[model samples]
Target chain A: MTLDTRTTVRARTATITLTGDVDAASASVLDEAIAAAAVSSPRRLVLDLNAVDYLSSAGLRCLVFAHQRLGRGVEIVLAGAHPDVAETVRLAGFDRVATIEDQVGG
Target chain B: MTAHRLVVDGLGAPSRLVAGFVSALAACAGLPPRQAYRLRLATDEITTNIAVHGYRDRGGPVDLRGRVEPEVVRVCIEDEAPPFDPTGHDPAPRVAAGPTAVLGGYGLFLALRSVDHFAYVHVGGRNRTTLCVLRCAAGG
Candidate 1:
C-alpha cells in the first residue's frame, strides 16, 4: 500500500490529500499524515481518499486517532473513498462520526 | 458437509487478498453479501491477530478449513500459537473520552454481529475459531 499526503492550509481550513490503501501495514503513514495536517491546528481536515482502494480496522484506528487529536472543532472529511473502503466505513458506522463525500478538492 | 482448505502467509501482494477471497467464496455460495463479508472479515481479523500479537509480525503459515452447506458456512481457522479463544476474550476498555478503542476484540464483536452463530475452542495449543453464518437465500 502506498500513502501519499499533501497538505494545503487556507485560512483556518486544512486539506490533506491522501491517496493509498490504508490497512494494517499501512496505517503508520496515515498516522503521520494526520499528524502533519494537524500541526497547523486547522479547523477542518479534509482527507482525500479519491485513490484509496481499501480501508481496514487499522486504517479506521488511524481515523479515530485523528478525531481524538483534533477534538470537536475539527472536521475530518473522507472524500472519494473507494467502494470497498466506503463499505467498510459504512458497515462500521463511521458515517455517524465523519463527513464523507463523493468528491473532494480545494 | 462441503469442505475446502486455505492457507495464508507473508509476501502476499495485497494484505487483505486472502480475506477478500474468503469473503467472495462465501458470497458466491449463497450467503448474503453482508454475511459473507462479515465471515471473511472475521477470518481476516483472527488471522491478522495471529500474525500480529501471536507471531509478533514474524509471520508463519496459518491454516483455514471450511465446511459449507446449503444453510450454513462453518469455518475453522488454525494457527501455530498459544491457545487463545477470542470468543471469551474481553474487549479492550473504551477510552470513552478519546478515540474509539482500537486495541482489539472489536473483530470478535464484528464477527458476532455478522454471523448467525459463532464459537471458539483451543485444541492442542492451537487457536481454533468456528464461525457459522446463515445463507439468506434459498436454493441459490
Candidate 2:
C-alpha cells in the first residue's frame, strides 16, 4: 500500500502525521518527508502514527534515519502509535531512542 | 489445506506490494490480525532485501508459494538470487540509536525474527526461503 504524510513545522517543533501502510515500498515517502522536516532543524520531531495501519522494518529504519540525521540535540518522539506498530518499535529496541506516546500533545 | 501462489515482477511498492499478496493469503488461512501483520512484515523485509541487495544487479522474478498447514501457515519465497542464508546473521541488530550510532542491516534479523520459523536452501538454481507462522497456541 501507499503512505501519505502531512508534515508541519511550528515554533521549532515539527510534526509528521502519517496514514496508510508503511511497508518497504512506501517508506521512501516517509524518508522524503523527514528530510524536509530536517531542513528547519526543529528541536523536536514528532511522528504521529495514529493513522498508520502497518509499520514494517523499513519504516523503523526511517526512524533511525530521523534519529541519526536529526543529531543528539533534537528530541524525537513517536506519538499516537497503535499497539501493533508500537510493539514492533519496541521489539526493534527503538523505544530508548525516541519517546513513544499514545497521543500527540496539545 | 488449499495452497496459494503469487508472482510479482519486481519489489516495487504500491503496484507490486509483494508482501501484501502474502498477507492476503495469510488472512485467508484464518490468522489473527496481529499474526497476519507479522507475516506481512516478515515477507516485506525479505523482499526488500532481495530488491535492494540480491537482485540489485539485475531484474528478476519473485514468487511466493503459501500453504495452510494444521499447525502453522507457511510461505516459501523463491527467487533467483545467489545463495544467501538468512539464518547466518545474528538475530539481534546492533542498534545503538545514539549520537554516533550507525543504522541499518536489520532486514535479515527482523525478517527471521518476526515469523515463528524460517528456513533457507538453494535448490534447482533458486533460493527458497520458507517462513512459517503458528496458527495458535493450543491448535485451532
Candidate 3:
C-alpha cells in the first residue's frame, strides 16, 4: 500500500521510479513525484512502473493530470509495466497520451 | 461456494485493504488471474468513489462480501455514503487522437466495462454495487 517514489533528472529527461502498489491511498505519492518532475520541465518524463504490482484508476488519473500539468511539449513515457499493469494503462486510455514500453531506457 | 467478507471504515484510506481482501478471496476461490483482476478492479472503483466522492473528506463504513457461485464469482459492495449510482453513463475521453481527453469519470466506466455483469442500487440510504465475472466452462 506504500508507494516509493524516486525522481532523477538527467540530460533533460526526468525519470520517476515507483516501487509499490498504486491504489487510492498510495497514488498521492506518485502525484507528488510527478509534480517534482514537472518543476524541472524535462523534455522527456519517464515513469518506471516495473516494480508496481497493482495500479488502480486513482493512479491512472494521477498520470492523466501529470500529463496535462507537464504540458504537451514534454514527452511522457511509461516504462517497464507488467503485462497486467500495461493492460490497465491501455484500459484507461492512457496509451493515447503516453508511450507504454515493456523495457526501460530502451 | 466459498465466501469471504471484509468491512472497512472509509473515513480513512480504505481502498488498499479492500482491494487486498478481494484479491485474496479470488485466490481462495481458484479464480483465474484475468477474472480475478476484473472483479477486483470493479470492486475497488465503486468503493473508492464512495469513500472519496460520496463521503468526500469525511465518510462512513463500507461492507464487502465476495462469494463464488456455481457459474461466476461475485463481489457486493455496500456503502453508507450518500446515494449515488456508479453505473451512470459518462463520455470517456476519445482514444483516437488529441491530448484534450480527461480521465475524470473514467474510473467507474472502465470498472463497468471490465466486469461481465454489474448492477447498482440505492436502498434505504445505502448504495450497493455488485460486480460479477463469468467463470469459463473449465471453471475459471
Candidate 4:
C-alpha cells in the first residue's frame, strides 16, 4: 500500500497518523512530518499507528529522531499500534523512551 | 534443528513487513523482549540499508535466514546489492544541546548496542550480515 501521513493540531498537541508500511522507502515522508511537527513545537505529539500495519527499524529511527529533536517536556504518545508493530517498538526499549498505549484504534 | 527463511523485495511500502515477521519469530523462540527488539532493530537497519542504498534504487530481493536454537538465535541476511558491512560504519555523532543536533542519524549506533554479536562480509557479490542473540536466563 502507498504510505500516507497526516498531521493535525489540537490545542497544544500535534497528532500525526501514518498508514501503510513505514520502512526505508517511506521514512522520508515521515521525516517531513517530523520536521513540520518540530516547527509547531507542540507540547504533545501523538503518533497514530493503527493503520500502520508495518513499522521498520528505519521507522523506529524516525520515531527516535522525533523523540530526540523534541527534547524534554514534549510528550510523544503512540496510539493504535498493531500487535507486532507495538511489540517491535516495546522491544526496542522505546516504551521507556515514550508513552505507548496498549490499545489500538484511538 | 530447523531453519526459517523469509524473502522480501524492496517494493510497495517498505521492508518492515519482513522485520515484523522476524521479530515475532524471535519472540516465540523465547528471546528476551529487549533482545528481541534489538534483533528486529538490527534486521530493519541492515535490510533497509540494502533496499535503499544497496541496489542504487534497483533493488531486487533479500533473503532472511533465521536459525533459532535452544540457547541462542542466529540471523543471516543475504542480499545481492552492494558490499556494505554494517559493522564498518562509523559511530553516530553525539547529539548536543541545541538546534544543531538533529534527531536522525543513529541507526547503526543503535544496532551495535542492540546485539551481543555482529559480523558482516561481502561474499559472492552479496552483502551477508549475521547477527546473534543469547537467550537470557530467568531473573538474570
DockQ of each: 0.28, 0.51, 0.54, 0.26
Per-residue alpha-carbon lDDT of model 1 for A3-83, expressed as tens digits? 777888898777777777666667788888788878889988888888876566777778778888888778888888876
| Candidate 3 per-residue C-alpha lDDT over B1-140 given as tens digits, one digit per residue, 9 for 90 to 100 | 88899987777667778778888888877777877777777788777877778778587888999898888888898988878776665445443344346556656766877789899899988888898888652443
lDDT of each: 0.70, 0.80, 0.81, 0.73
Error of 1 at B67 (Å): 3.7
Reported per model, the fraction of native interface contacts reproduced equals: 0.11, 0.43, 0.55, 0.27
Pairs that clash in candidate 2: none
lDDT of 4 by residue, A39-79 (tens): 98899888888888766656777877787779878988899
RMSD, candidate 3, Å:
2.4
Model 3: TM-score, first chain: 0.96
lDDT of 4 by residue, B46-137 (tens): 67666667765576788888988878788898988757777776344442232124444345655665677888888888888888888783
TM-score between candidate 3 and the true structure: 0.90
Sort candidate 1 into its docking category: acceptable
Measured by lDDT, the strongest candidate is: 3
Report lDDT (Cα) of residue B72, candidate 3: 88
Q: Write the per-residue lDDT of candidate 3 for residues A1-106, one digit (tens) a residue.
A: 6899889999999999999988888888888889888899899999998898788888888877787889888889999998778888887667888999887787
Candidate 3, residue A42: CA error in Å?
0.6
TM-score of chain A taken by itself, candidate 4? 0.92
Native-referenced Cα lDDT, model 1: 0.70
